[model samples]
Target: MNDNSSRPLRLGTRRSKLAMAQSGQVAQAVQQLTGRPVELVEITTYGDVSRESLAQIGGTGVFVSALRDALLAGEIDFAVHSLKDLPTKQPEDLALAAIPPREDPRDVLVARDGLTFETLPEGSRIGTGSPRRMAQLNAWARELGKEIETVPIRGNIDTRIGFVTKGELDAVVLAAAGLSRIGRSAEVSQFLEPDAVLPAPGQGALAIECAMTNAPLAATLAELDDPYTRVAVTAERSLLAALEAGCSAPVGALADLSPSPDEQIVTEMRLRGVVGTTDGKTLVQLSITGPVPSSSEEAVAMGHELAAAMLDKGAAGLMGERAL
Candidate 1:
């Protein structure tokens, strides 16, 4: 997987501050792993240019299409993406070359007054546009018999958090990974537990993609891959696909590798999945744990099995309400 040439690897990235920061980290890591120089190629995408909200623009392929296009067109040798932004279906011509070690996979609350999900006052308003978060938050609030409002919001982390400073909203929910990526983790008031709010599948992960034709490049990129992280996210994304859920749908899944404590060797991998309506009226959740995965296919199969279990418990009807 050695690059004999001196040319730098062109890493395509969206031109947002967050995307640039993410790409910069990836570029350094890939360069160190492959012994290849890496360059960041900024690309403007429909999602970045559109004034419309994420729901209006459609969700799955928004931020990623331009990068994929650049890769397919040979404009960039490789690209990086927030794995959650990627669709479940893989393209025949493009290969997901690597998924590096993930960051914190849990969501966080950036609330005023250092408040948390449990400590937030009754009727407190929370801001988030993600159906996955909204649904789970609503369901939890209902279970607690606390009447909190979930406001729809769209923008970068700074803009979303601004609502609290401007007194436009009480609080906002954001991924812990995003805040951490930009060195803003200090701003997080509280990290929500996964049991309270299951994170979007592949929330804290990155997808490195390259054209399928580039075997040498693929091998180089694969050197940067963390098999455990890849397998875990594969299980999560596989659940999403088996459920026929869109990336924007109120579906959340998290997979973890639980190694035996004494030996520090992975013994089992557990996956938990949730499906719910936007209104939080109906929610279906399931979990499955078995032997540690030996291959990508086994990990994906575990996710499908969990999805089927949830579907048997009326996960489909809960998801159906999302369309209505």
Candidate 2:
């Protein structure tokens, strides 16, 4: 560890409970590894201040720009973010220093009175604001010949859960990782498998960002980087980048690392792209698989190829419409 006894490393984070919890974990890790004190600074972001819908507020960058501005201004030494909330592009001065071990990268169904998907009544109301989730749920419901209504719901995890508990909605879909981080995993009525609901890119992972010039601090963060998580998330993000999809785009991807007998890890990834009308009446989804990419560039290329295939099949037209 570099001798920085004079100044503690300042860690910037959003004020949300989950964000604080994740930042606390990272601060603790850095403190242990570097033998330095870490200071937590709560920063308010546009996403927190604006009442506008996420898509209306300009996609996912609202949550990240403030924290990134602080980093660039040297107001904080590092920052933590929910990887899924990050945009596909990175700023010139900032570097994604680390991707720690990922949590469960699956969406969960939370329903009132412990009801599972199979048991929910016909015409039951589900709540979620994600176009990706809405599309998948609609497609699956169609396959089952089940008539269910998806209601647009948005807020923090607690607020979203309240919709179900308060009898406003029969169920809601949320990231299993978010629930688990907040110690509310028990609220999950069912863990939707990847085969049924592919997760958004970089879900369940935490991103550490720091200024590119901060070599010493960046090196310290490197200790926390999990290679498996990095590779998997890299591929997923690459796919997102290739598609030119923002965080709100109806794109999902999951990557798995299968180790070969020769002790080499083979990267395998599946990408799912969806396009849907605003009313959720029609949707087109495409899935593609390829060998794990050797680099972020390669992974991005694979994602681009898959996206091109989907577009050729008229995905662009479907996405052009509003998705509620």
Local accuracy by lDDT, each model:
0.89, 0.81
Cα RMSD to the true fold for all candidates: 2.2, 2.8
lDDT of 1 by residue, 255-289 (tens): 98897988678899889999988778888988999
Candidate 2 yields a Cα-based lDDT of 0.81
Best by TM-score: 1
The true-versus-predicted C-alpha distance at residue 83 of model 1, in Å, is 0.4
lDDT of 2 by residue, 1-324 (tens): 234676898999999988988899999999998888999999999998887766676566889999999998889999999999998778888989999999999999999989987788899999987877877787777777788898877788999999998999999999999898889998899999877777888999999999999988898898899877876787777666655667776667777666566856654656565555544567666777777666777767766777778677777666532222
Instruction: Pick out the ten consecutive residues of candidate 2 with the lowest summed lDDT.
Output: 315-324
Poorly placed runs, candidate 1 (over 4 Å):
1-4, 320-324
Q: Candidates' TM-scores?
A: 0.95, 0.92
